[model samples]
Target: MGLYHNRPHVQDIRRMKARGEKISMLFVTTPDEAAAAAAAGIHMLSIEGRFFDATMREAAGDCFVQVGLPYGGWGSFNGRPLATAEDYLRAAFHYAGIGGDAYYCAASYDIQKTLADNHIPVVGHIGLIPSYISWTGWRAVGKAADEALALWRHTQKLEEIGVFAAELEVVPDRIAAFLAQNSSLVMLGMGAGPHADAQYLFTEDVCGYGLNHKPRHGKVYRNLGPELARLQEARIEAFRAFKADVDGGTYPAPEHVVPVKDEEYEAFLKAAQG
Candidate 1:
């Protein structure tokens, strides 16, 4: 706890929402990216459990970090899928002990309640959950009037269950704006709109290293793909030069080898002859 004394706590994030301040959030996988986000003063970060550790937490610095627990069959324990509330609770505690400020759980409501009941700060998901996309398909949710009402009810249910925040993804702007204002839970908007408590995006999407199918909501700031390719080519060239030198006997040349004194060599030669 002392290690995280300087980092923003749950209450600090709540205060940001209360003050109507727009927060910036990113999903980062590497320590370098976390450190860079820390240096850039990003307000929040979402790190998956596999990538979250003491080193990653330290690199995140003062940013409020939400550790994502793998949902349903995606998480395993001793060859079994994590399908129960206790399974998720154990995972949540593990990350919490590692310095996670909050947890992102797209599990069932009952599981979410278990974490919330234990006083763990939890963030739930709404609108086009990728795991549950078989029902909604890969498109914006809550577009129709009935779907919008259902989304509102879903938000209310989350608040009732004690979830402190939700990842409001790919919903209409007006619906998201209304939900953010009316609901107690902080809205971590992906493509929800400008009015959500925090604007969230994946670091890969922001850095332009993502796959070809870019989400309409994502904005690429810098194209690092070409630069990364260039660096790879340079690495190959350097390795090729080393191989060529070794094959041509240019490596281990006189300057690269240790020299034996003439007197020492002569002494050894005379002793051998004797």
Candidate 2:
């Protein structure tokens, strides 16, 4: 909201949701995709901090961007090694300063609160969180009564900590509905059900470029894989053609050869002789 005056932001998303707006969100990596998303009227974007450089932000136009903090593996898995909660606060503030609309962090409630304290709109993660996927065995959560209750309780804790939104991932429809209906938090559904305020998906999944077969949750709208394969084949053919041209001495045609003055050539010849 503050210096993000140049673009529509979290405040805008919140306002629209309060008025019962339905929105679509996507994970994007390119300015081209951002432009398309803006044109498509997508309300929210979950983008890596590196992906939302000046170009992508400009492409985003008025759309809100939730800058994703790292979620998994080696360094900063669940954001622990990245920094203390205070460190995330500073990082979040920096991103916000540069026009990030919100910050997505799967962290302890205390850590999430730290970001909110610094005026960074925090989007928390719940229900089959990826970083802790090993514990849940990489599957749906909130299906069991106790587990679902825990998720509900966690949602309450997140609300109490003043998170702006919560990403509900791979939870049962009934549980998602219950949480969305009960919680004041803006529920963004990713592999969750329709009750959520916004539907979210990764770019790779949406464009049909995801590894292996598409997940049951993903609706592969286009067969980018075949197109991509065709493109790759074309690229290989291009390189092969260029190789043939070079081998056949067909490259460096007269047009490609630089013109040199006779005097300059003579001078170079004389210098070499000397």
User: Which is the leading candidate under TM-score?
Assistant: 2
Best by lDDT: 1
Error (Å) of candidate 2 at residue 43 is 0.9
Clashing pairs in 1: none
Segments in model 1 whose C-alpha atoms lie over 4 Å from true places: 1-4, 75-80, 239-274
lDDT of 2 by residue, 39-141 (tens): 8888788888656667788888767888887643423523355556866776677676667888888877788888887777889988988778778877889
**Candidate 1 lDDT:** 0.91
Candidates' C-alpha lDDT? 0.91, 0.82
Per-candidate alpha-carbon RMSD to the true structure: 3.7, 3.1
Candidate 2: residue pairs that collide: none
Q: Model 2 lDDT vs. the true structure?
A: 0.82
Off by over 4 Å in 2: 1-6, 72-81, 243-250, 267-274
